[model samples]
Target: MKHNWTTTKLIAVGAFGVLRVLIWLPFVAINISTSSPLLLIFSFFFFSLISVFSLLTIRQFGTVTIQTFVEWVLELPLPSIAFMPLLFAAAIIRALVVDLLFFFLRTKEAAASIVCGGANSLVLSALTYVVYLVMGIPGTQTIPSAIFTPIGLLLASTVVFDLGSTGGYTGYLVYKKMANTAVMRRIQGAQ
Candidate 1:
C-alpha cells in the first residue's frame, strides 16, 4: 500500500488541530479566564506555541505545509485561541530556528537530524513552559508539566528517527526478501 499522503495528511492535520482545541477548551472555559499568568500560559499561550512549532516543523521536513496552514486557520476561531498576531510571530521564529537546524546543523544521517530536531523542539517547549512560570502560574502542576517536556521531546524524536532508521530499512528488506522468493520443495523427494 502506497502512502498517498496528500489527502491523508490533510485529514491528520485537521484532526490534530481539533485535538489541540479540545485539549485547551476546558482549561480556558474553567480556569485560565481569571487572568492568572500561570493559568494563561498553560491553558492558552504555551500550548499554542507548541502547536505552531510542531506544525511548522512538520511542514518544513514533510510535504504537509498546506494542510498545516488550514488547520492552523481553523484553530484561530477556538474560544481560547491566543491572538493571531502572536501565533504568526511565533511561527516565524520557529520556522527560522528550524531552518537553521536543518540547513546549518544536520548531517546526512536521519537519526542525527531527528535528534537535533528533537533537541530544538524541547528547548522551545521548555522556553514556553518557563514563560508560564514567569507569569506566576502555580508550580504545583506547571512544574511537573515542565519536567515532562523533555520526555515528550524524546518521544517525538524517536518517532521521527524511526521513520527512516535501519530498523525501518530492515523491515522493508525482510518484506522484499519474502516476496522475492517462492519455493515448493519436498525434503523427502530423494527418498
Candidate 2:
C-alpha cells in the first residue's frame, strides 16, 4: 500500500522524533558520566519502546529510521565530535533492523517486537565496540575491557538481548492499549 505523507503524519513523526531525543538525553548523560553498561539496559528498553510504538502507530516503514535520524541531528552538538559517528551509525542500524524485521515478518505481533528489539540492541552494541576498536579511541571502553573476552561478550550480549526484548514486549502492550483509545482511533483514522 502507498502511504501518504500528509501534514499530520509529518507532524506526528517530528513529535515522536523529539520525544525519542528527550528520552535519550538523560541516558546519554548517565552513560557518559559512569561508563556503565548497565545503564544501557534501560536505554535500549525505552529506545525500543519508542521505536516500536512509533512504527505500530504510524504503520510506516521508515518511521523509526526517520525519527532516529532526526534524533541524531538534534544530538549532534551534545556529544563530542569523535563519538558522533558512532552515534550516527548506531541510530541508523538500530532503526533499520527494527523496520526490516517488521517489514519481512509481515506482522506486528509481540514476538516480532521482541525479535526486533533484541536484534536492534545486539547489532548496535556490537557496532559500537567495532567502531571504537577501528577508531582506536583511547580511554573509551564502551563496555568494560574485561568484557571484551568471548565469555564476557556472550554474557553481555545475552543481557542486552533480554533487556531489549523486554522493552519491545512492553512497547507492544502499550501500543495495544493506546490503539483502543478514542484519541488513537481518531489519529489513525486521519491517516
Candidate 3:
C-alpha cells in the first residue's frame, strides 16, 4: 500500500496529543493532592488503558470526538461505568480528529500526528487558561485540576511514548495552530 506518509504521521502525532490529554491529565490531577498510592496507581492505569477506546473510535469512524454525542450522554443519569467512560471517549475522538485532519489536509500521517499533538497542547493549555479566567479564580476542584491537567497530559504523553516521540518535539505548537485549521472544516457537521 502506498501509504500517505505525511498524513499518517500527522494522524499519529495529533492522535498522540489528544491521547495525552485524555489519558494523562486526570491521573496527574488526582495524584497531586491525594496520598493514596493505590488510588493514584489505579487512576494512572485506568486512564492509560482508556487509550484503546480512543483508537477504537477512530478505527470505526472518521469523525472527531463526538462532543455533541457526549453532551447527550451527560443528559443520561447513568452510573459511573456508563457515564464516566463516555466522558473519556473524547480521547478516541481526538485520535479520529487527527486522522480526519490528515485525510483532508492531504499530508503525511506523521505531520498529522505532529499537528495533532501540537493542537492538543495548545488547546489543552488555552482551555485551561480560559476556564480559569471564566470562573474568575478556581475553587478546589478547578484549582488543582488546572495546574495538574496539562502537566498530567504531558506526563502521560511522554510516558506512553517512552522512546521520546511526538510529545517531546511538537507539543507546544498545537494550540497556536488551532486557528490555522479553522478554515478547513466546520468542526461539527450535522447533529
Every model: Cα RMSD to truth:
12.8, 2.7, 12.6
Over the stretch 1-191, how does candidate 2's per-residue lDDT look in tens digits?
Answer: 23555556666777788997888778767766786545746778887777777777777778778887877777767654323676577668878877889777647477877887787778777776566567764435555777779998899999888887887788889988888787665556553
Please give the TM-score that candidate 3 achieves against the real structure.
Answer: 0.35
Model 2 lDDT on a 0 to 1 scale:
0.73
lDDT of 3: 0.38
Off by over 4 Å in 2: 1-3, 79-83, 136-139
Strongest candidate by TM-score: 2
Candidate order (TM-score): 2, 1, 3
TM-score quality measure for candidate 2: 0.84
After the best TM-score superposition of candidate 1, give how far the Cα of residue 152 lies from its true spot, in angstroms. Answer: 21
Tell me the deviation in Å of residue 90 in model 3.
12
Clashes found in each candidate (C-alpha, N, C closer than 3 A): 1, 0, 29
Off by over 4 Å in 1: 1-5, 37-68, 95-191
Residue 56 C-alpha lDDT in model 3:
22
> What lDDT does the true structure give each of the candidates?
0.42, 0.73, 0.38
